[model samples]
Target: MSRFHLGLIINPLAGLGGPAGFKGSDGVAQQALALGIEPKAAARTRTALECLLPIKQGLHFLTFPGPMGADLLAEMGFAHQVLGQVHEGPSSAADTREAVEALQQAGVALILFAGGDGTARDICSAVREGQPVLGIPAGVKIQSGVYAINPRAAGELTRRLIEGGLVRLASGEVRDIDEAALREGKVTARWYGELTVPEEGGYLQQVKQGGVESEELVLADLAAWLESNWESDVRYVFGPGSTLHGLAENLGLQTTLLGVDVIENGEVIAHDVSEAQLFELVDGHPARLLVTAIGGQGHIIGRGNQQISPRVLRAIGLGNLRVVATKRKLATLEGRPLLVDSGDVQLDDAFPDVVRVWAGYKEELLYPVGK
Candidate 1:
């Protein structure tokens, strides 16, 4: 049997800017590094690659040299062929594009890359139309639809493809936001292009839905319900999204629109906190995590809320999680279960199969949850 050829690429600085309040990592990796922000692209890529370990003997890996790809593969003991070289410093967008082009020329079965929208844009610019590619969600500005629901999902889907499972090919939109505008509290998302990706609705994330929730009354009701149910001394961690932002406004709490915030005793205590800070705040305290599904993606965790790390989730406990979304948003999922990719497989698996979603005032719907 012929071994399947797999191409791997990792953008080393892909997510450095997210927790550092730089909005995106396109050109601010150095600044983020200077501010002590650690990059997580390699760690996230490792999670995706772990699923393929069982079939390593039947696969041939091709990747760029050094931090871009080969370093992690070597550390994990995956035998792979290095295709290109990295210069003296951090890999740039050109390196990513060059890696994609080289991988295409090598005629690999699929190219698996780890990065945010900027990296997706690089791949889109270099890959030929209809070529198969998949993304591991390792970046901060994950506005594009190319990424899997999480790192593990990416590995699982790749494994399925190598194992001859029924995986269809579909076009995923490549969208990006203006980081400068995003820093100024403005989200300017534009559709750059699309890439062909492995399609398994349960494994892949949909294009992030833009615009405000059309039903104003539903948000008002959600806010009222949350306010009425506020528990004294219980810290409430608010994940990012339009729904949560609107709810914060309704409750007259000043919360960051696209960053994690904490509420205690009906007052905002921490705004735009990182994973370390969140774990510190919620560690020995009773906390409830309030998160809403991404409008069209059906993801309640690990899409854009990486700040709510696994340890933080463990500290808060899974049972204390409160999911809020309009019925219309849930309808967009077309009956697919709400997904969670907390980066910790055990914790992701620990969530109950069924969850209660707060849709309106005193109204809750039993929804299915998936990993």
Candidate 2:
């Protein structure tokens, strides 16, 4: 049997703005530096690739030079053909497009890219309609449906696709939120384009659309349930999004619409915290993490809530996590499991098979959770 040709592309600078409280990591290089953000795209892509190592045989990998693609694969001892010119500084969207064209010209069977929605948009621009592509979730604003639940899931899907399992190609939407407006606590998401994503048992993500009228009503009901359940002794770490922000308002507490906030005894303790700050606030306190799903992505972690890092989740424990979302938002997934890419593979696996989502006032729905 012949080998399968797989194209690999990595946006090394993606997700740098996530932990720094930026809404998205687009062109905020200087601000990301000032906020001391570190690149996580390579590490995230490697996580997916690591999952494919066992079945690496009979799979021919094609990648770009240096950090754009080849570096991590070489370090992992994979035999891959590098394409395109080697660049010194930060890789641009042009580099991604060029790599996609090169891989297409070389007749690659599938392409896997690591970045958020912007990167997905780039891929959509370069590849044809039927070209199969998958995304390893790596950026801050992942509103697109092309990304796998996480890196491990990406690897699993890739393995299934290559091993001739029952995987189907579906047109996934590429959506981008206005970073400037997002920073100002307003989400302006628009449909950019579409790309072909691999889907197996409804494992792939769906494009996010913000809450509608029904979801808004459900959020109010969910807030009522949460407000009545609050404990004075437990410190609550609230993650980002309008859902949580609305919940905070229902409790008469102010919250940063795009950053993590902490509340204890009905008082705001910390606002717009970093990962380090989250660790400090949760230390020695009975803490509970209240996070809402990204409207379209169905992600509770590893999208814009990097402030709730894997370490923080481990520290708080999964039992202390309270996920809330409107039933309408959950329905957007069409029965696909909610995803978590906390960047810690083991921690992600520790999540239970199903999580209880507070979808309405005193109403809960058991939803499947995936990594």
Candidate 3:
């Protein structure tokens, strides 16, 4: 029997900016590092690769050297060949593109990469139109549809492919946000291109929907309800998204549209805070997490809001979470359960099977939650 040849790429600095409150990890990696932000891309890639260990004997990996791919593979004792060398310093976008080109030439069956949307754009630029690729969700700006819901899901999909299970291919859009605009409190996402990815509706995340919600009255009503229910002693941690931003506007509070903010007693205490800052503020305090699902993705946790880290969630507690989304946005999911990929497997597993979503004025819908 022939071994499955898999190509691997890891963007070592992919997610450093997320927890550091840099919005996106494009050109500010060094600054984030200066702030002592630890990189998690390699760790996340390891989680994905761990799922393939059972079939290690039947697999052969082709990847770039060091932190790009070979380091983690070597640590895991996978049978892999190093394909190229990364530049001496921190790996740049050029390194990712060069690695993709080399992997294409190697005729590998699939290219599994760990990065955010920017890395997806790099892969799209260097590969042939139909070349197969899969993304492990390990980057800050994961607005692209190419990534698996989480690292474990990426490996599960790869395992099925290697075992010759019936899998279908589909085109996923490669989208990215302008980090400059994102930092300026403006979101401008443009479609770069598309990549052929292994399709399993349950495994792959849907493209993030970008636009204004059509149901203006519904949002206003939801915001009103939240305002009426505000507790003076409870700190409100607002997660990012247009839906929550609308809620903030209702309260006449300036908030970061793409970053987490903390409010207490009807005042914005912190704006665009990092995970560490958030943990410090909410720990041992009465806090309610006010978050909304990604429009089309149905992810109430861990899509783009990394500031709401596991410790932050522990501080806020699951019972204090208030999910707000318009019914129209919920319909885009087509009855799929909301997803939570908080990076802590046990924490994600502890989430209840169902959650209550505040849909409108004094209205709540019992929605299902999934890992």
Model 3 TM-score relative to the real fold: 0.55
lDDT of each: 0.84, 0.80, 0.84
TM-score of each candidate? Answer: 0.55, 0.54, 0.55
Candidate 2, pairs of clashing residues: 208-296
The candidate with the higher TM-score, 1 or 2, is 1
| Residue pairs in candidate 1 whose N, alpha carbon or C atoms collide under 3 angstroms | none
- Residue-level lDDT for 341 in candidate 2: 86
Off by over 4 Å in 3: 201-371
Error of 2 at 115 (Å): 0.4
lDDT of 3 at 329: 77
RMSD of each: 21.3, 21.7, 21.7
Answer with 2 or 3, whichever has the higher lDDT. Answer: 3
- Tell me the tens digit of each residue's lDDT in model 2 across 1-371: 23557899998878888888777788885588677777889999989999888867756789999988888988988879999885567788899999999998876767899999889989989897666789999999889999999999999988765543435556789999999988898889999888877677432222234424365676677767777888988999999999889888877889999999999888999999999999988877799998888776779989999989887897887878978876666656655567888888888867754455666676644455655
Q: Name the candidate, 1 or 2, with the larger lDDT value.
A: 1
Task: Quantify how close model 2 is to the true structure by its C-alpha RMSD in Å.
Answer: 21.7
